[model samples]
Target chain A: MVDGSARISQDPEPRKNNRVHPVLKLLYKKRWAYYFIAPATILFCIFTVIPVIRSFILAFQEFRLMGNVWVGLENFKYVLTDPVFHRAMRNTAFYTVVMVPQGVLKALILASILRNLPEAVQTFFRGAYYLPGVASAVVISMVWKWIYDPNFGLFNFILGTFGFGPYPWLTSPKTSLTSIMLMGILTAPGYYIILYLAAMKKIPRELYEVADIDGATPFAKWWNVTLPLLKPTTLYITITSIIGSFQIFTSAYVMTQGGPGYSTMTVVYLIYNTAFRDFEFGLASAQAIVLAAIIVFISVYNFRVFSTDVQY
Target chain B: MRRACWVLVLVLLIGSLAVSFGSIGAASKWTGTIQVWDFPRPAAAEEWELQAFKEFEELHPGVKIEYTKLTWAGGNEKLDVSVAAGQPPDICGSGLRLPYILQGALEPIDDFLTAEDLKDFHEETLNAVKLNGKYWAWPWYNTLYVMYLNADLFNERGVPLPENGEWTWDEFLSAMQKLTFDRDGDGKIDVYGFGFTFQPTYLQPFGFIYAEGGRVLDIDKNEFILDSPEAVVGIQRLCDMVWKHKCALPGAGGLTTTDVNNAFLNTRSIAAFVDTTGIISSFEAHNEKVEKGEIEGEKINLVTAQYPRGKNGQPIAAGPGVGSWAVFKQKDDAKREVVMELAKFITRGEGQKEVVPLIGVFPSCKSAGNVWAGNKNLEHIVPAVEYAVYPPMHPNWNKIDEKIMRELQLAVLNEKTIDAALKEAKRQIERLLEY
Candidate 1:
């Protein structure tokens, strides 16, 4: 073996070059990776990026059935002065303020409970909770419309059993937004719960065992070891929930129709009505851009609020 | 061998193409699909439409008809979006509102209709479909507001019905008050005196406004004058019915016309309500149920009455509702003609006569009206047609209607003062008109 190695080492080595283009070299190295991601990248460009750019352009154009004309800032001026747009923004803000935190907290608590259960029971509860998450929002909204009917509603019926008089749920302006928010908090937390549980399961088991050996209570172990470790997951769920709550439209559309004096109006609902109902696509596009800005601002604010430097 | 095979394949391709083209060229028949959309009609009328389409297909062997029935609730929005996308139906049954015509999506029927066909239609009905001095749609049927009285409830309460289908506003108010009472000695009222929806499309209140000689949009001035004194009084009376007198249901702001109709026919919880003549069939069915002892209430002698005369002593009625077949701009002249023919056939032929009794809508064609003339069920329909006010024809009335209805609802709910609501609505409408 020594003699063969000595002979192989005596042979001349191949030359290496440093003259290849960096981009071409990179392409050669990661060709398989690029090939795998190409389809998804092309789809995103076509469906998401291109439409977004077009919507921005459309915000400054007066769109007609025959043609579109450039009318810079006119649509923005209309949106700024429109009272309905203001009301829509306020309603969306109210919904985000109430629903996002409630959803996150409920999801976190349920996920904490789910993590401690036996594996078999945990699977059952997770499936049960996630069932509603799989349902279409429109179908859920239609069911909720019946549940909010003043004459015969499940909520009023339950309240009536306790000797309270019937209360108008979706019919009254006073309760319409709250009713929609309540539906959101109750039905949608399941998605976050699954996410949180998956994150919780990833925590090192040794940390919990060490906390137990140090005479830590279950709650103390969760607080001291689990929560800080789950910071990234919390931040993600919080950001997504806030963005989702800001875009709330289906319930307002299917159940209330932004009615009872526009109490349940959401920004997206207004955009839809402006574009399709009023045939003001330019103003609708401006409204959509404003909504996107709001979602971006809120998402950044959430990251600043909840993001923490914690590592295992 | 390979060269021979290539030549053989080329020959076969050319031969097949020639055969297909030759067959198509040999036929002299017109061939294409005509798309037709209509606002939702009753099952009977829908059957009539299907039968008529079959007949049309048979008359023209190569022509095909694709029909889509749309609900009134969100049909207009769907139609608007489709038209905006430049894929409008070749023909559709719509109200022929000014906004649709102003969009230049409709084809004027001016050149298509012969003088005889034009003469066959009611002149006023024909005028209803006109904009910019051109006929944009073929009038099919028309519906106007009529007061539907639950006669059994009135009789049980000893409330005198409107004499000769006429009443003054004071008498109407008095009747509404007399008709309201609590049963079972409970403080809670089970039966409301009047059934009126706050829904915008259910423009029963427009009749009242018209009765007052008040107009909403000043078409000449191109401004909304909803805050005018007469209009204010008209809206105030409607609000008073819901809030001050509590004659309407507590949930009036949320109830749709369908809900009001249900309360009248099935629940028998309302004494009287104003609606279009389309409710006659539903009312008749309720009476049949009562006669058969299927329901607990006594048989109702459903009667139609005129809207109460206003301070002007005029019983003017208006509906923002009309039924007409509109022709869209089709690129091909032949297809356009085919669509117009289909529209004419539906509006003037057997289809027109078949839908009147089923839906209780008055036909726009005088000859079609003759089919149900002297029919006891439609006795009030023809009389009510005389009072039908053509809704304001401004291009922006759709948005104006929504704003007025929303603010009017706010006033009715006591969330804002009626004056404030009207002023705000007028401001909103002004902004829209400016746009």
Candidate 2:
């Protein structure tokens, strides 16, 4: 460390001669950097770090009408073996698996298609597709609820035109989860399309022009140039989509209510039920920690797979 | 730059000082302002709430009330968040479950009520809000499950009107079969005989387990008694209504409150199974729909009766659900006294009389029942109240209800045998009781 500092001091121009003390000089040079970082650092510690530590401590304590009691890992043991917890895990896993690939593929295709359109038309289409992402989940879920109505829904009306019998979209245990997943896939691809489109726009036109001169078709250009350039955005979207899908509560809470008999009872919904509905906060917190761990593991795995040997 | 920095520091210091003093100022006054949290109900109830507030301000000259409405579906979570933030409302409406008390978010009101105060309220209503020998709330209203019938359908089919509130399994099945009809001769049966919901609220009939000489829990021992032979038989009979008898409409377990209510209102179903609150408005609003001329050569009437008796011959209504107001143990003695006074004023006979007619909510005071009966519009609810039973006061009641309701649904859906489902549910409830 001393040799590195001495070599910097031995520069030909003698630029360091006016420095009173090395430590003071270092502080003065990076003062603006410290100022720029202060707000986010304070906020992150107060909100994110503090709550996580507090929730961990709360997981071991039994909260009841009288007071809290320290009860070691009893809460963890109970949550792991609880039937509702098991069902929630299964449902959340199914949703994550279904939503991630479906969301990414559709967003990719839309982004590639939007790339070829004129700028004005492209902006209009992008905004149109992105509208669902901007709309509140509560509003969208309520509207979709009416659309899934068995007797009077637009879906059944359309099916009737083809002479199909009425389908109970949100009522049947068999179809409820798939019906919700279809809605998620449709509504969530908008933001990912915007991300991928932005990344596609940043790629130099020269690469695509060379591909065209070299007799590359549209499919080949998308496969070789567009997809490779969009790798970083794809990784970001994949991780976020998996995390978002695992935390799905609003749809199930509003529409199916974890039912047609627990078919849509996701992990976060069970945590909510255990904590608020049943007042089992200790168990709820333990389940939440497990859920958070699962999300982190899955996200890390996705990042490793998509981040290997990739550059913009 | 130095001047701007001084200005930023000055602003933040002043903000902190204001915050510190503002809380102290708030702590010193009754301020005549109270915050209330309530869920939106039907338009009539909303109107009644506004009127009640208007009357309250006139009676208590300086008090000002602000009301915030929450959605029924998310009210509990909203209340939880408020409590966690330590800013719970001065007054709130809650369901009988009252999750806050169980979770340690509520303050007991025992010290606020005197012995004389306790004597005036009905024992059953008081018992509903009491936990561990301390009263947590003032009981507001009550609801129970009752069987509503389409009397005109009974007359057309020549079936008896379910006398004595008792029917054997075969008799109930035969009556439903007679009520089913395909009026237009289409392949489809346009009108179902009986419509029932499979939600947790409807599982009240499972209370027949007790009526049939069975126990849900050995109260003294805290052991689950759901696997007892009598209890199994009672549950099996409920599932048999859907699976074995085919008396109820298909997909009945999946039907929601809206679905069943619409079926009855549209006259698509003859005999409807619903709570007393469910049919009151329909019977009042569309009396003409069931009138003689509306259905050429057919007449319709509305009647309600207790649920049918099991083999034991005793008809039991599952416990009535109750709602109540709880006074928080305020840190300030004067504020606490005022809150207690507010609770007493809302629950007194005069208050009950003022609100009962507009809201149709049952009175918690026994004498208030007379007020209920005197209203010609509310007279029908009296008989239902006569048979009301409060559910067991266990903190785990909601969890147990969820498990049993799921088992009942599985049996109704034919996904599992009745015995198997009952056995699993029994095991689950036993585990919960241990906790």
TM-score of each: 0.78, 0.73
Q: Is the docking of candidate 2 incorrect, acceptable, medium or high quality?
A: incorrect
Give lDDT tens digits, candidate 2, residues B111-215: 778787687666656767876677788776665566667777778778897664456556766887777776667444555667765565455455445546565
lDDT over C-alpha atoms for residue B126 of model 1:
72
lDDT of 1 by residue, B1-435 (tens): 999999999999999999989777645445789988888878888888888899988877789999998888888877877887888888887746565687788899998889887888766577677665788898887777788887888888898887767788889888888787787574556678887756655578677777777677766567787788888887888889877887876666665566677677766778888887766776678678888889777666787788888876655666655688888888887778778888888887456778766766777776765555666544644655645776666566667777888787778777789899988888778766753
Q: What share of the true interface contacts does each candidate keep?
A: 0.41, 0.24
| Chain A TM-score compared with the true chain A, each model in order | 0.90, 0.88
lDDT, candidate 2, A1-312, per-residue tens = 579779867876755555568787887899999889989999999999998897888799886544567999999888888888899899999988988898999999888888889999889988999898888898898788777766556897788678885787876778888988878866747788899989998999999999999999989988998888888988998899899989999998887777767777899988898887777788788889999998999899878888996795
How far off is each candidate at the interface, as Cα RMSD in Å? Answer: 3.3, 4.1
